[model samples]
Target: MEKLRIVFMGTPDFAVGILDTIYQNNYEIVGVITAPDKPAGRGQKVSTSAVKEYAVSKNLHLLQPTNLKSEDFLAELKSLNANLHVVVAFRMLPEVVWKMPKLGTFNLHASLLPEYRGAAPINWAIINGETKTGVTTFFIDDKIDTGAMIMSKELFIGDEESAGELHDRLMHLGSDAVVETLQLIETGKASTTIQAENDEIKTAYKLNKENCKIDWSQSGKMIFDQIRGLSPYPAAWTFIKDGENEWNVKIYAASFEAKEHDELVGKISTTKKEIFIATKDGILKIVSLQFPGKKRMLAHELLNGISFSENTIAL
Candidate 1:
């Protein structure tokens, strides 16, 4: 069979893995569509998208368009005459573009369809305390992540795994799945399954700073999941009164102490080794944290200098 002409669209590290897999397998990638470069960081230096960096290294034809529907970019996309367009970790494509390909456009979503079907699926799945999360590839439609499924694969989430750990696992799995899907498509053996809409839908919208505040009123298990879900990035935070000035601290790693606390919820119970905060059901022993203007450090290290008074409470 003739090699299928593929156009890849993606912007982040998650997408790079699948792109590399396609190249390794000798698939014909006619063009790559990625986000345009923008100024980033304190220095405001211009930075390219992750997909752009990889495309540059591989000498792939790339298009970085700010406007997807612009006539020139649309013409460029049509000029490629690609058989399939694969989208992973990329922006939403309009019908004019996604419908242009002969084999149609498909997206690789981080979570199974009809669940966790928004921007940050991996983080939200861990945050919501899901026992299992998987990846899916589906045909692109008008709604976000609501398309019919082409392929689905399940992955187990360990009890003690963090979001970052799960991300790495899924990234590797997703790469292989995409390549397999491509091979099946080329051989006219690809099978598609329609997604069912049920009441069990859980959205994984983008995380915001305001949503990272720890709610002490929640149960210890809920709070624990929330902390781990946001750990290492957009961390779960709480405020404490520091000499009449409120200080915000982000908690990265914590475990439930399974202790009975006589203190009220949101009260701090600390020792030289750990810092436990009373929750609705139990206590949360914070192991790692980051305070304002300071790097992330262990709870014991922070307690060494940032002392908590006998009557202090974590708001």
Candidate 2:
């Protein structure tokens, strides 16, 4: 059978792996669609999307449309004569675009469908304390993540794993799943299962500043999960108050001790080499953290530069 003609759409580093795999396997990629260049960072210099960078390096036919529904963009996309469209970490598509290709468009989502179906699947899965999460390749429809599932690959989430760690694992797994789905489609052996609608579905909404704030009133385990879920980026944050001075701190790593504690929630207990905060039912031993305007460091190292007063508490 002739190789499938594919048009790839994505914007981040996660999508680069899948695009590379497809190219390395000698599949025909007719075009690559990615986000437009935008000013970013301290200097406000223009930065390109990861997909665009890779596409340029390979000299693939590229499209960076400001509007997906524009006639010019649609005309260019239609001219590609692509049999299938593969999306990884791209934005939602209009029906006209997704329905244009002969084989339809499929997206590589970070979680198993019908559950944790939203923008931040990997982070939300760990935040919700799930022990297992996986990647899924599904047909894209009008609604987000509400489409027929073509293939899925599951992986175990480590007890101490952060979202960043799981993201790297899923990135590779998702690439393999995308390649397998394409081959299955090319062979006329692809099958899909309808996603059932039910109340048991857990939605993975986008993370925001309010949601990332740590609530000391929760159990130690819950707080620990929150810290790990957002670790290394948009970390779980809390306000530390000492007398009249207050500062915001982000917790990157922590351990939970479920033993009963008499101290009030949010109270801080510190030693020369350790920092512990009281939770509703136990204690949270902070291992890694970052203070406002300071680089991330171990709790002991942070303690070396700053001292917590007897009345210090996390608000």
Candidate 3:
């Protein structure tokens, strides 16, 4: 078996955990590849990726390439002489980059192989009302996430779990998977199998503004899941019209009452300490929410300062 000289490639905060786990386990991480720093937020100050910040802190050899296909970048990558490549939460790789390493490139996915394969797996799993999801480590192939599977670890979803919560759990779960996958690869025992084909597979399409809008027409349970699935980030939102003065409101946390109701689906009723929106099957009780230009807070706190008139309706 070849001695492990690994090249790590990833960008978001989720990738940091997996990268750190490998570093802590005494792996020879010869190089780290992350995204280039760019301006962000209202202030527009330059911001580095989470992985870049961590890599700098550890003084690891780092490279932020604007183009993975460039000859210069490829030349630098080749000089690293890495035998193994580990990817997580990163962009799709060009064949030249992924195929360079001796033992081949493998990725840690947030969902099981051939399922929930896309940009936002954790959010879609919860948004689709799935009760279970897991992490998978697989060797890289030409296709995205259709690689031969090495190993997977499953986890049950809580009834009220948000994507943020599930993301953290999966990150830790990925740590264990990384160690096992490395052991298998280095020991020459990593027997990968082709992914199972299923016609009923679900995809995690990327989240955008159009899809993030909350549809009151959906059942209360579905709306509840939608809110939780996208919570603590790009939240589900609706137009709150209070006596003709309308504004967008983002719902972060909520509870639902699944029952037969005659009220209009988008009708909004409010109390001094509560806000309820009627849905297809029942009422959706808002727990945490954010109004335009304000931070997210408890529902009751919002109701305290902003009272909706009788014309209250969530559009």
* Highest TM-score against the true fold, candidate: 3
Off by over 4 Å in 3: none
lDDT of 2 by residue, 1-315 (tens): 546999999998889988999999899999999999999988999999999999999999999999999999999999999989999999999999999998889999999888899888999999989999999999999999999999999999999999999999999898889989998999988899999999999999999999999988777888999999998778999999999989999999999988886887899989999999999888899999999889999999999999989899999
Candidate 2 yields a Cα-based lDDT of 0.93
* Model 2 poorest 10 in a row by lDDT: 215-224
Candidate 2: clashing residue pairs, number = 0
Q: After superposition, how far is residue 3 of candidate 2 from its true place, in Å?
A: 2.3
CA lDDT of each prediction against the hidden true structure: 0.87, 0.93, 0.93
TM-score of each: 0.95, 0.97, 0.98
Candidate 1, residues 132-222: lDDT per residue as tens digits?
Answer: 9999999899989988788888899887678888888898889888988887888887888788888878999889987778888888888
Residue-level lDDT tens digits of model 3 in 51-154: 99999999999999999999999999999999999999999999998899989999999997688999999999999999999999999989889999999999
User: In candidate 3, what residue range of length 10 has the lowest lDDT sum?
Assistant: 303-312
TM-score of candidate 2 relative to the true fold: 0.97
Off by over 4 Å in 1: none
Candidate 3: lDDT of 147?
Answer: 92
Which residue pairs collide, candidate 2?
Answer: none
